[model samples]
Target: MSGTEALIEAAKKRAAYAAVDEFIRDGMKVGVGSGSTVVYVVERLVQRKNEEGLNITCIPTSFQSLNLINDGGLNLGDLNRHAPLDVSIDGADECDEKLNLIKGAALTLEKINVFNSKLFVVVADYRKESKVLGQKWKKGVPIEVLPLAWRAVSNYIVEHLHGKPILRMAVAKAGPVVTDNGNFILDVDFGEMADPLKVLTDVNRIPGVLETGLFVDMVEKAFFGTADGGYVTVDRKGERKVFQ
Candidate 1:
C-alpha cells in the first residue's frame, strides 16, 4: 500500500482495536458497521473472540458486513433475535462535536441497529472528525426512498426544503444504485446545516423517504484515530479525552 493508504489503515486498526477492547464482552451482542474502516473492527472482534474466548453475537449493518462477520467466525444474528444489544460499534463519514454523524451505507438497517443498542459508539479515522456536522463530509446526505417516488422526493427537497438532490448512480452498473431494500438513493446537499436534527425531520416529512444518513441524538460516544497511533475520544456530554 501507498504511504497514505498505510497510514489510514493503521488509524483504522487503532480505532477498531480500541473500540472492541473497551466495549465488547463475553456473550454480549455487538453491532458491526459497514465500510473500509469497519473492516478492521471485524478483524479485531474475531481476534478477541478466539484468543480471549469472547462469545459475542454480531449484528451487521449490511450484507457486506454480514459476510465479514461470517468470515471472522463471529455468530450472526438480527435485531429480532437480539434486541437491545449490549453495544453497537459503527463507523461514520463525519462526526460533529455533539457526536451526531453522517453515514454512507444502508442507513435503514444501521439506524435500527443503533437505536436498539444500549450503547452506540462510532469509530472513525481523524479525517472524519469535524467541529460541526456537514463540515467535513461534503458528498451530501444520503437518503433512501421508494424507487417510484425518487423524483417526487427530489423535487420536494429542492423546491420546499431548499436543498440540491441528486439521484445516486451506480458507477459500475448502467443504472442507479439499488439499495438492499430495493429502494433508490438520493444524495442531498444542504450546505452547512445549522440544525441537523431539523434537517433530518424535514427530510422525513416528504413521502416515500425510507431513511436518511443523518443520525441525530443517537450516538453516545466516538473514537477518532489519529495518524500517530493514538485516539481522541469524545462523548455526548462534549467531553474530550486522548489515548496515545
Candidate 2:
C-alpha cells in the first residue's frame, strides 16, 4: 500500500483499538457510526465479540450501518429503548484544525447519535482536512427535513442561510432521495463556513429542517490515520498528539 493508504490502515487499526478498548465493556451498550473507517472498527469489535464473547448492544447510525452491525454479529437495539449510549464511534468528512467536524451521510441517526451517546469518537484518514470545516466537503451540507416541509426548508436554506441548495436526487433511483428517517434531503452549499456551530444553529432554527451535517462541539475525540503509517489524536479541547 502507498504511505497514505498505510497511514489510513494504521489509523483505522488504532481507532478500532480505541473503541474496543474503551467502549466495549462487558454487557455495555454501544453506538456504531457510518463510513469507511468505522467499518474497520465494526469488524474489530465483531472479532472481539466472537472470540471473547463480550456482551454488548449496538445502535446503528443508518440502515447501511445497521447491516454492518448485524453482519458483525452484534446485538441491535433501538435508541428509543436504549437511551444514553456509552459511546459512539463514527467517521467524519472533514475535521478542522480545531478538531471540529462535519458529518451527514447518516442523517437518519442524528438524534440517536446525539442523545444515545455520552461520548462521540470520530475516525478518519488525515486527508480529510480543510482550513475550515466546510471547505473540503463541498458536496454541500446534507440537511434532512420533513417531507411536507421540504419546500420551506429549501427556501430557508437559500434565502435565510445564504446557501445554494438543491433537492437531493437519487440518480440511480427514480425518486427524490429519502433519508433513513423518511425525510427529504437538501444539499446546501454555504461556502467557507466561518463558524460551523453558528451556521448549524441558524439552519436548525428554520422551520421544517430536521438536521444539518455540520456537527460542532459534539465530538469528544478524533483518531486520524496519517500518511506515514502513523496516527494522531485530537481532543475536543484542541489538544493534538502523535500516537506511537
Candidate 3:
C-alpha cells in the first residue's frame, strides 16, 4: 500500500478497534456489519474473545459478515437464538454532521441488525466525514430492489425524484452486482441532499424497494477516524468529542 493508503488503513483500524472495545462486553449479543473497516472490527473482537475470554455471540448483518463471524472463531448467532442485540457496529460511506449516513451495503439494515440492536453506532475513516451527505462521498445512495423491478424503480426515481439511478455492476464479474438477498442495487444520485429523510420517505413509497442505504436519525453514535490516528465521536445530539 502507498503511504496515503497505509495512513488511512491505520486510521480505520484505530476507529474499529476502539469502537469494538468501547461497545462490546462479555455475554452481550453484537451485530457485525459488513465493509472494509469492519474487517478490523472482527480482528479486535476475536482478540478480545481469546485474550480476555470475552464470551459474546456475534450476529452477522450479511452473508459476508456471517463468514467473518464463523472464520474468526467467534460464537455464531442468528436472530432465532439471539434476538435484541445489545449493540450493532457498522460502517458508513458518508456521514454528515447530524449523523445522517449514506451506507453502501444493506442485507440486514432493517431486518434485525439496526432495528433489533439497542444501540447503533457507525465507524469510518476521515475520508467519510462531511458537512453534507454527498459532499465527500458522491457515489450516491444505494437502494436495494427486486431484480425485475430495477427498471421501474429507476424510471420512478428519474421522473419523480429527479435522481439518476444506476445499477451497480460487479467489479470482477460480467453481470450486475447481486446482493446477498438475491436483489439488485441502484446507486441513486440525488445530488447534495438537504433533507435526507424526505428523500427516504419519497423513495420508500415506491414498490419493489427492499432497502435504502439512507440511514437517517437511526444512529446513536458515530466514530470517525482522523489522519492522526485519533478519532472523533458524534452523539445523537450532534455533539462532537475529539479524542487525540
> In angstroms, what RMSD does candidate 2 have relative to the true structure?
2.1
Compare candidates 1 and 3 on lDDT and give the better one.
1
Candidate 3 segments whose C-alpha is farther than 4 A from its true place: 107-111
**Which ten residues in a row are the worst by lDDT in model 2?**
107-116
Q: Can you list the residue pairs that collide in candidate 3?
A: none
Question: What's the ranking of the predictions by TM-score, best on top?
Answer: 1, 3, 2
TM-score of 3: 0.96
Local accuracy of candidate 3 as per-residue lDDT tens digits, 71-179: 9899998777888899998899998888888998864453358888899888999889888898887788999999999999999999999999999999998989988
lDDT of 2: 0.79
**TM per prediction:** 0.97, 0.90, 0.96
**Candidate 1 vs candidate 2, TM-score winner:** 1
Order the candidates by lDDT, highest first.
Answer: 1, 3, 2
Cα lDDT tens digits for candidate 2, 12-37: 77766765676567777788888888
Candidate 1, 42: how far from true, in Å? Answer: 0.8
lDDT of 1 by residue, 68-104 (tens): 9988889999899999899999999998887888998
**Candidate 1: which stretches are off by over 4 Å?**
none
After superposing candidate 2 on the true structure, give the runs of residues whose Cα lies further than 4 Å from its correct spot: 1-10
Supply every candidate's count of residue pairs whose N, Cα or C atoms clash at under 3 angstroms. Answer: 0, 1, 0
